[model samples]
Target: MRLLLLAVIAALPAAAHADEAAERGEWLARQVCSNCHTISARAPAGRNPRSPPFSAIAARPDVTAGTIATYVRQPHANMPDHGLTARQAQDLAAFILAQKPR
Candidate 1:
């Protein structure tokens, strides 16, 4: 029981940080990605039908935060380069991953 308690305490800070990152990512998505992608589950499809919703992306089995970050940093034919900093991309990835179906 003591070992378990110690482990849980050690993990709390990391879990809290992840939660914070997810929150920041959600805000950034609403401000920027909302124009093209549906950033939240309840949001209507974006004007660009070709752009996928964050939920769909999260649902994919192979999707990972690193992959999402890489995609966000690259220039795409349809997506305008937002020049998001590395930390922003990380936060966005965290937010998107949080949308994965439980």
Candidate 2:
């Protein structure tokens, strides 16, 4: 019982941290990515038609936090380099992944 209690206690902070990260990511996306990509679920299209919506990215089978973190760190075609920190990237990934349909 003690071991189980300890395990549950240890996991509480991780869940809280993930929630926090996702919140921060949402803010960052609205401030930055919103200029091009559709950051909100309610939005049908982005300011730039070529940029994929956050929902679309979240729906991809191959998308993961690690993959998004890596992709955002590098420069890509038509996408500007935001020079996001590792933590910010992870938060952004968390926010994006959170949009995945249940």
Candidate 3:
């Protein structure tokens, strides 16, 4: 029983970490990117006609996870700075990268 309890304790932290990561990812996507990009697997069209879907963005071979994070941190002149912190940007990037091409 003690060994079982210890195993559960060890697994609990990992489960919590995954939950935190998923929550952060969802928050970042909804708060920041949902307006312009579709992060869902459903691939709903973007609200902005000019903006591409998240799947499309992720499909680009040249755009790696690091590139996405950097771009989010330093967007182009036309793009408004959403004022996301570094950690938020990284979390957002991870979320975006997690999306597989539909």
User: What CA RMSD would you report for each candidate?
Assistant: 1.1, 2.1, 4.5
Clashes of each: 0, 0, 0
lDDT of 2 by residue, 25-102 (tens): 999998779888987676545689999888889999999999998998899888999999999999999998988866
Q: Per-residue lDDT tens digits of candidate 3, residues 1-102? A: 999999999999977775576569768788767787777775455588677676777788898767877888786875678877877776776667667565
Colliding residue pairs in candidate 2: none
Which candidate achieves the best TM-score against the true structure?
1
TM-score of each prediction: 0.94, 0.84, 0.70
Worst 10 residues of 1 by lDDT: 38-47
* Candidate 1: tens digits of C-alpha lDDT, residues 12-40: 99999999999999999988999889888
Model 3 ranges off by over 4 Å: 1-19
Candidates 1 and 3 compared: the better one by TM-score is 1
Number of residue pairs clashing in candidate 2, backbone atoms closer than 3 angstroms, sequence gap of 3 or more or interchain: 0
Model 2 per-residue lDDT at 66: 99
Estimate the overall C-alpha local distance difference test score of candidate 1.
Answer: 0.93
By TM-score: ranked, best first: 1, 2, 3
